[model samples]
Target: MGMGRRPAEADTDPFSGGIFNLNESFSDRIGDYLLGSPNLSLPVADETFSLHPFPVAAPLSTTNQETRASNGHEAAEGYDMGISEQVSATCSCSSQIVVTFEMVEISLHLVTAPKGSPGRPSQAAAMNIEEFLRDHKRALVSCEMLLGCETCSCRGEYVMLVISICRKLLHSVGVMHREGLSEVQNRDSSRERGGLWKLDDEDQAGVLEVLLKIRATRLRRLVTILDHVVTSHDWPAHRSMTQDLVRRLAEA
Candidate 1:
């Protein structure tokens, strides 16, 4: 799990609420708003259209102080759990775009294991899955087939293939083992950070449902997360409900 380049703001990556600003004593705190985009505002630049970023906040936090206290490991677990839920919502969607996004996020959850965790094997498998998801996402970057595939067949040139954006910090006991992800890997993609987009409601939920279909075990966890996100939208993040369901899974 040794990636090349590094992200520009790797140190400042927002795992919790410290990255947003809402004037509620700390950051933006856009958890509720991000959970379900009522009116998404995507920007068009240089004649290229794409989805927007995750807004000015995270959709799974409350107090900025609490976010500060929680380290990357805890954040990784919580975020992965949340992501699982999102996959379920889109599992039913038949769109390739939605399916691609869900795969990318699930891949992120699998690959983003930090160092020092006793589950290195699990973490390695996760990274491999993440790489595959990214490749799949890249294949769908441009409406025109970037790669020769059954769905699309278009030659390159005068093409604005922005591709996909995926990121995660694998951690274990507060240490990030897999480093140097931002290196100059892809010839087309100079930096480690590639372009990403904020999916709309139907697209977002549709993507989740597709993921659930691929991994049935995810359905239960995703339901728990959906209920939690809908309940308060103003409480601290937790996966206790989902964890209870997963207690039955075994390494066997």
Candidate 2:
């Protein structure tokens, strides 16, 4: 007799004629459907489904490593750029400071006077007083010689005028020296008393005024001496010296 198959076993059998194979039939129908309707899509075993194209995500470990490497490279580049900028700024500031220092030095040189220059007030004052005293003494001697000269007949009025000028210059010098000594003594006494020795503006102005007046008087006396020498005609050499003195005084 032929072996009989059970209903459950027949349903489970792949070769059963009543059963349909969905895998084979669906694959064949999918191609037909895609061909008939150009927009249709089918599911595939090795791919993920999506409405739009997208890159497949990698495993978390590999993705994290790649990201970290990229971030480290970017950070290195940024750090290098920052260091270069800071170096450039430091160099620029150093150069600016050097230039500024040079400018300040040049300004100081321009403002300060050289040593031993005639513009120094103390030196000028001492030299002027010495020269003035010498010139006055010489003029006095010249006038006396001319007055007593038997070779030339000198005018009495001119001789008297020159002598008076010389005497007046000598008197002014004596008075100025006495006043200066007194002022020095006063200053010393004030310092001994523990007082600060400061010159007031008004006192400075008054001293300057007196000095100007003294210079004016000296100039006048020099002019009188020159006039006497020219009018007396007794000393040609002395006339030249007097003229030189006048020129020096004017220059001063």
Candidate 3:
């Protein structure tokens, strides 16, 4: 026995109250619409996968690296050039040399007041007198010795002049000693107005004696120096002048 075919409405349009179109293929038309849609063609999956965007950097080439190094070297060379110029200028200034010379001067004065005078002698004053006299004596002795030596360049006339000066100094010393003795003798009368005790005649005489002894000692020293000058060497050219100076000093 053969099977029977379905009814026409049931086979053609069951969902639309049994209505159907017979000309088009539905599955093929749906496939074509999906391929042509603008929304479906966009890359939505790529945008959704990455939430943050990042910038990409390119790698440096060898030529660019070399150019940077050369620029740095040129900058360093310019800095060093300035330093070198400064150093050279400093050296030039230091190369110049300078020298200087100085001279010194000394001055001395003698004290002639008696020890028994109104005012007592200061220790400093006494020391200064001694120092001055010592230096003066040393200078005179050295000059005399130099004149005596044959190797010395000093002339006989110069020695004679120096001896004359010494004689004058000795006269001045004598005058100072006499004044000191007179001052001691008169000091008592001068201080009487102040009610100070007057020194007795014996005391005055003792002070004068001391002054005389000091003068005698100085005279002896001067005579000894003159004798040394005369006997230490022979001055044939200045014999008469030397003798005259010696005679004058001895009389003083």
Better of 1 and 3 by lDDT: 3
Residue-level lDDT tens digits of model 3 in 1-252: 121322121123222221122111221121122222222222221132111111222221212121123555332111222233343333221111000000001212234444444333553443232233333343344334334443221223335544544554455456545544454455444433211223454555453444333333443444455555555545443455546655654565
Q: Model 2: C-alpha RMSD to truth? A: 57.1
Judged by TM-score, which candidate is best?
A: 3
Give lDDT tens digits, candidate 1, residues 31-140: 11222333432222212322221122222222323221245433221223323334334322113333445555554444444434544344334443224323332323
Residue 237 alpha-carbon offset, candidate 2, angstroms: 0.2
The prediction achieving the highest lDDT against the true structure is 2
User: What's model 3's TM-score?
Assistant: 0.31
| lDDT value, candidate 3, whole model | 0.35
lDDT winner, 1 or 2: 2
lDDT, residue 174, candidate 1: 13
Residue 174 deviation, candidate 2, in Å? 15
lDDT of each: 0.27, 0.36, 0.35
Error of 1 at 167 (Å): 8.5
How would you order the candidates by TM-score, starting with the best? 3, 2, 1
Q: Model 1: residues >4 Å from true position, as ranges?
A: 1-94, 115-121, 129-252
